[model samples]
Target: MMGLENGITDIPYEVHSSEDLGRYLIAARDLMPGDLVLTERPLVFAPKALPDPEACMPCVGCYKPVLTDVGERCAKCGWPVCSGNCPGLRDVRHHAAECEVLSLRPDCVLDNMAEYYRHDALLSLRCLLLQKTDPENWKKLLEMQSHMECRTPGTESYDEADEFVVQYLMNNFINKFDGKLKKDVPESSKAILHRICGIVDTNALEIRLQQGTELLGLYSNTCVMEHSCIPNTKHSFVHSPKDKNDVFKITVKIVVPVVKGSHITTMYSHALWGTQARRQHLKDSKYFACKCQRCSDPTELGTYLSAMKCLGDGNNPCDGIHFPEDPLDDESDWACNKCKVKVSSSQVNMLISQMGEQVDNVQMMGGSVPTLENLLCRLSTFLHPNHYHIYSIKHSLVQLYGRQPNYMSQEYLDKKIKMCNDLINITKTLDPGNARLSLYRSVLQHELHSALVLTSKKANSDGSFKSDEDVKALLVEAKTAIEDALNCLKDDMEETAGKKLYAVIEKTKKEFEKYCKEKQLNI
Candidate 1:
């Protein structure tokens, strides 16, 4: 066991290592829900590679997107910055050290849009620069996991890092520094650069700013927690905007009661992905196969996220659902629980791939009610009602209803209500602790409240709208739903969508209560 550094003492957690789990954080004291377990700023942070060529380029200093045709550039380095006087460009820990390095490559033309995409190397360069500027923190970073062996010469990971990061840095800047080295880069320096790249890839967490600029941040203590599909803790970030000197930091809070010796966990994969998808992602990116409880269960704890309807041959149509016999094995055959009919893993993969493509298409087409409904209708025959694709489509549908004037009909409202209820149930079952799915569940709750409020106004078959008693009952439910939604978003930072939604829902809740008071409809 090693003590945590970076002034991370007196927290309810201890850093422990095991043969199987490597270095991980464990609860040193009993933790209750909402317990503030950890808070730490990034060891290093940098802008992500511009994934969208058509999108505005981000300022290298402050990471804000350059919205105007020609944005401000740093006075010293000539790199894009939100302003010529950006503080981030002056901060020693951020762009200050690298600004010197980038200045060395003055001849390199950065006018091309493709040149902006080279920002992938920016983070690794920052990490490498730490070796000189912040040597102690740099040592701490090297102690983190790199999994270098898994990313050897022939691997795609190796090739990407080698070409984009290591070679770029050496050829453009490092080799030219002081004109001290030969044309050929030294193996030791190259190895360190590669190791830095791996560390960033493995440890960095993806973050999106309020303005929708995406970046990566590597934390010292927070990155040490182990990964779980159903994490016991939820983390929120405090992003620093240009006007605020509030450096970016993260807060990790316990979402469920955990015993003193339990592992402090955080999710590394999307909560909505199926077992295979999650496991494969972990294996590919983190270089480890996840054997978490959720991954081991083929039925995904009965939510059936990956299950498909087992349509038997023409003569004998079976009504069983197909699930992986051994979910941990990538090539495990899928079998029907009822009819015992078997399907190859390849066949199942193909089906999932094809359905996923269709789902993507529908989402790209704006996910309108009619499109999602038609897709859901066609897919309900071949997929379980709770399939992740179906779940995703329904999630889109949940928000679409009541937002548009044409979607306020009884049928759409009914569908929205049903979808909200079903999604809420599935999300809760998968994330019983409500840590990983807080924002998602909050959105569902808000949508459900909206649907209920709208449904209360529809005329009954008897030609009368909802009675005072009925409307009051519905309003009470709506109030509870909004309250829960607000509770889930209470930790969200300002200027975020969650915070805006919270304000809107708070007003809606007041209106609901006001209507009840005016009508004299006491509960």
Candidate 2:
């Protein structure tokens, strides 16, 4: 058995294999919420598959964004690099071995290449080259489960265009390596190249490196954890402060308690997404039909995340949630819980698609308060108040309420406070202990502090404070809220959102203390 490394102990987790599911991770003992479970470094890391037109020139070694106009390029191959003598480029990077091979191959030339073909083959090429230089790491990679045989035309995993790119890498690149590399490579076989591509597609996680660049990282042990719609654990990528540009580690923590022997799983699909959308995305990307509890429940654990508002022409609209007749089948009819009215799956699909487009447009408007409010009002005509679409809009509104220009009024701050509290309640049921929950709680506390301070100031100016006790009470509430916000934000300081919240909370606390001293109240 492969044991946990890096001083990870008392984790209460074990690795197991099954005939049907291959390898998976399970809890060996009872695990509780907020427990640290595991940490790992990637076996192989490469840039993500960027859209052809949207591809930016990131450094080949550390994956840092490097502008083409002034950035350095590799001396031999002319690919993006931090500097000619960069430590990663000189001796330790993946680019060192492939640079010479790419420099000689006629078809491997980088100039005037199409956008789609730029990054599609880079990860596979890196894996193949690793076999020559880092044999042990290559061997570990080969042990991974790659569902290459299942990539058929009729299946959800099929992608004809990507497959063509894999073929090009094998025929035009790998098969034409330099004589030195050719002798080092075991065999210039397309089958091996295909398997490498399949492995990356199946198991790679999107790592958000420093400076906001995203890359694909392959973790040997963490990859074995299965997917769940409502996952028990969450993972975060922590970049090394000593070398922020290149080094990163994945930290997985338990978000919910689990019994001994229960499977330890993480979310592949977003927790906020509707059931149908989440399941469809899993099927298309991961090549699996999810039968998790959330997928099986028609009401989605009574959250009604996918419900549409009934358009009945009667005196009262149908007070019912709409759900699929058979939760597992996409073509199943949808029925109303109260009116017993049925809607075709095709119709529901069309409606959702159209609404999704509108939501995208509103999101693209840069989270303006009026624009989001208008969008929410329009969405309510056809969507339940608690629908994911409406929830998303409200979530955006809460974030923008106090930050936008002309939105810091006392009225607006009170509105923001109420919205934040409401969101916290919903998130407790839908995404408990999520980083988003920490964010929401912090924002709610900050808004509460702002509103209380503003109210206290107005009352004092208007000579409306009946006694000093009233002012003391307001100051106490504001101080407590700021403290709560600080506690919730303690673990998230590395993230941009968390840093911003921390700064705001600290500033507010200082201001509150100053005001308290002015009143001579014991805080």
Candidate 3:
């Protein structure tokens, strides 16, 4: 195997001897905290899904990734005015193109726009976005329509069609499966939509996704990441205003040591559950029987806190199954149900029929919806909180409660934030660059600031701008909330972090000015 030579060949790595693993010398590899393992071009670049886009606002003046719906246009020049008659996204060239398509069949425009945009936007808009970002690609993309143009015969649009296939294949076209040889595909199409198998090996790519997308989750597609029972990385999405891409971008980071040949993994979702529960989730989403080491173990490599003692007497849990007391235990011990013999983990598994009787009483769907609190309770009894299951469960508790501000009271809110703060400490050690964890901490801290405001306001006799002290305290709380939010999100400047900070700054500035204008505020 012609492996990658270390970039620093002049100063080779020092191979050290270790008594452990029965090895005289260990082959050491250097993977710095932020080493770039590999990055392939995006597999697919279709417009991201947008739900309930802002109204027809000219985006040119609004900035690259603005969210407002309406903008005005100057009627004289046929350009954007400001808010109301926002200019078309692009200048005349783009609008002229939109007009041509709308003109082809005026009736089709509305429906086409409706169908395209309802998931979030119209075809005209998607085209505009594509044009704005990659104008060259968009120009070439325009040629695609010629193949489908009304005057043209409905033949295989060889020219326009070729480019579409190429783009599609560039981002997808993995060959992990057997059979269906590349040579068997159409000759003309094969040249561009080439075999994508092993372009970036799936195993290594999973790790790469962890580093690149896990934190911000900025990129979506084959890169749409999933987590694992034993996760190697943690991630979250960051939304930024300065970004050219409109979609919320995700960022990620490694949370553990990933070795060569180890399948680098990230949890698609929370990994609070035991092996069975986690496997069922992947099975549902990815539709693959996880043969990963974690999934392969019935005990989940001893992480299955919920594993029951099928042959136990319910006391202290059980010493060894009492022979006559539990006939099932004896029966499974390579003997009769009433006979006495020790049982194996396999026997403990086969006797699972006894555990299912309780399943009918539980609300979880094949165990899909276990509460993190409950999972935590189980883990508390069976594993350490630092255990992967506990880590996942603890984070879930923080995320669920933190997001739903309306539901919890001051006391509950305090506890939730505290949990997240603790989680922050843990993540700092495990996944220091985990953006979601940072966002989670940011939210909790912001909420805590809210709680502080409420407390201060409660102490005041009346919520009014009457005195300097009242206004000062209120402004302080506002400033603190904005600062906490800004601090947590500052690292993720390219996405939501930037948008949120911009919003906070705007709000804080507006409030500060408003408060100064008032007589004196109490609340």
Q: What C-alpha RMSD separates each model from the true structure? A: 2.8, 3.6, 14.8
Put down candidate 1 lDDT per residue, 399-494, tens digits, no spaces: 989889898888888888888999999999888677777778889999999998888877875777778788778778887888888887766744
Candidate 2 lDDT over 1-523, as tens digits, reads 4445646756568888887667888988899987877877667677754344234566676667665546676777767666787766754444677676555543333444444235556777777777776787788899887787787545544455245556666555666676777888875586676677678878888766546667778878788889887788877777664654335577777877888899988878877788889989987667788888889998777777888867654666776767898989999998887785788899998999898888888888676888888888888988877788887887778667766778866577777777766665666676665643577767767776776666666544455654667766777887887887798776677666677779978987997888778777787
Which prediction has the highest TM-score against the true structure?
Answer: 1
Could you give candidate 3's per-residue lDDT for residues 486-521 as a string of tens digits? 565654545444456546655744664465467355
Number of backbone clashes in candidate 1: 0
lDDT values, one for every candidate: 0.82, 0.73, 0.37
- Candidate 2 TM-score, C-alpha based: 0.87
TM-score of 3: 0.38
* lDDT, residue 229, model 1: 94
Error of 2 at 397 (Å): 1.3
| lDDT of model 2 at position 262 | 93
